[model samples]
Target: MPATGFDNTIEVVAVVVVVVVVVVVVVVVVVVVAVGVDVHVVVALVVVIVAAVVVVIVVVVVVVVVVVVVPLVVVVEALVVSNGLWYYPHL
Candidate 1:
């Protein structure tokens, strides 16, 4: 077996992130169930799930912005530059 370099690395990364998030969500659900249903615990689990989802969304958004926006900004800058048409926006 051999690995190939990803051309659309951001898409690949997003896919991986989605898979991981699904797995983690499932695991968290199972843990919540196994621990016995309690209102507080269920609430906590919901919060955890929501938080995980938010984090994943944020990660995907940031990656996408970097992948798509950065290049567009660069090209636009090359074509025509504003005061700050293209600059690395640090996280």
Candidate 2:
């Protein structure tokens, strides 16, 4: 039995095809990395915005509690004391 040999044209075509496939894969990977970086930046910006909103809300709540509720309580206590409602019965 005689051995069959591989064609030279086929060998060259195979090499070219392999190189093209590798180049396409590298391009795709680079594009994916760029998109991922963009996504990360957007997410970071959103997180910062959300944190700022939360801080503002907390400050407003603290201000209202300290400035409004405390004064109201003090006024109510004063009125009660002035009306003889908190008198002691010690002789």
Q: Which pairs of residues have clashing backbones in candidate 2?
A: none
RMSD of each: 7.5, 32.1
lDDT of 1: 0.72
| TM-score to native of every candidate shown | 0.57, 0.52
Off by over 4 Å in 1: 1-6, 26-30, 81-91
Q: Which prediction has the highest lDDT against the true structure?
A: 1
Q: For candidate 1, report its TM-score.
A: 0.57
Q: At residue 24, what lDDT does model 2 achieve? A: 53
Q: Encode model 1's per-residue lDDT on 1-91: one tens digit a residue.
A: 3332335677777787878688777877777777777886677777777887787887778777877887787678766545564565561
Instruction: Report the Cα lDDT for residue 28, model 1.
Output: 76
List, residue by residue over 1-91, the lDDT tens digit for candidate 2. 4332322434544565566556555655665567665776566556655655565566556556655687688788778888988874561
lDDT of 2: 0.60
| Residue 75 shift from truth in candidate 1, angstroms | 0.5
Candidate 1: Cα lDDT at 1? 34
Please report how far candidate 2 places residue 59 from its true position, in Å: 0.2
List residue ranges in candidate 2 displaced over 4 A: 1-37, 87-91
